[model samples]
Target: MIEDWRQRRAAKRITSGDGRALKRLRWWQLPFRALFYLTLPNGDGRQTEYAVDIPRRIDSEGGKARAHLYLDGRHHAESKLPAAFPVEGGTIEMAISAFGLKRCHYVTTAGAQHRLIPDPRSAEGRRARVEREHPTLSRSISHLSALILLVGVGLNLLQLAEPMSRIPPIAESIGTFESPVRLPIWLNFALAVGAVLGSAERALRLRYGVLDRAGK
Candidate 1:
């Protein structure tokens, strides 16, 4: 009976602690419809803090990417990849999560003239690694972010449809209003321009991450 109880307890522990590492999702913060989430052992067992911008591009069906890794206030890893590349050129990838530890996967395919390495250490080396291990995953993340942002902005613009539906009529009505109460089209346009410029500035500020992927 004692042995049976011991066996039962051992089985319980094994079931609960399967020993498979996993990334944990802590929280996500979104700015400009861009989300930055925290993880440790969840996405990739990298144990590193990462920032990503899911993207929306016209040429590709989908994409997602690890935007960058946090090193101080700056990003340690960043990439500028076109939305679509001939599959033959290769790929880039990243994984992030929150847990006891972290792991990341990277993979790539080499062309006839280019060499492919299963294990890499340099900047290009790292990029190659990403391509090999997580080609599709990388692109999906990047594409996703852009798609979401574009969709969000589109929705916002849609809301203005009702108000803007009668622009010419509204303009005529405004003319009859007292000079003190009248809002000129030029003034409204200027306000819009200012808001757009402000949002752009914020996007620029979000820029982070620099990878010496070439191992330089």
Candidate 2:
């Protein structure tokens, strides 16, 4: 019931795109741009290309950032973040997080979901290339990212618990609690930086989870 309501709200947020030619991705824009593509059948045995473009570093002064949809290389429609754009078979869902995109996929009428392919020159594209060319190494890196996020989140929770336990109401009821793990300020800052990079790496692969989201 709640999902349905959220879907309707997202649908309402969409606005028609002005007719403009989609720009090509440039080298300098690789870090701040995300472009994904989907090729779907056009009923006549031909394929139609749809692209979703988002400039992560750019934002509107008064509203949420928008995701632009291009059909066959021309602007079609656009919507705010966490967009759900209706297409041939289903909806193209797009979402973003602090580090990068957390979701960009197509959900079919049959309930199956498929991720859109990133542009070959983009950062995400380079990451995807690495995965294809070096499967074992890619798997290892992915595991390391998860481990980093886990440690970061665990430390954060412990740090929070110590302060919360010191509150008068909680301390009176359950006694004072001390955190077992504590690090110097500089080391903590370093770990926080590592956590952000780890989350960004996962974002390049379109991976998201509770720990990944929390680390961001």
* lDDT to native, each model: 0.32, 0.89
lDDT of 1 by residue, 1-216 (tens): 993464344333221122222222222312112323333333454553333333222213224222332322333344322111112123223222211001222223542222222113222234345556888964564454344444444444544554565578875666322222334677555544443433332232221121111111
| Per-model RMSD to reference | 20.5, 1.3
Judged by lDDT against the true structure, how good is candidate 1?
A: 0.32
Q: Model 1, stretches more than 4 Å misplaced?
A: 1-51, 56-180, 200-216
- Candidate 2 structure quality by residue, lDDT tens digits, 20-104: 9989999899888999999999899999999999888545563677899999999999888989999999999999888899999
TM-score of each prediction: 0.21, 0.95
Residue 22 in candidate 2, Cα distance off native in Å:
1.3
Model 2 whole-model lDDT (C-alpha atoms): 0.89
Distance (Å) between predicted and true CA of 119, model 1?
A: 24
Q: Which ten residues in a row have the lowest lDDT in candidate 2?
A: 57-66
Each prediction's number of clashing residue pairs = 58, 0
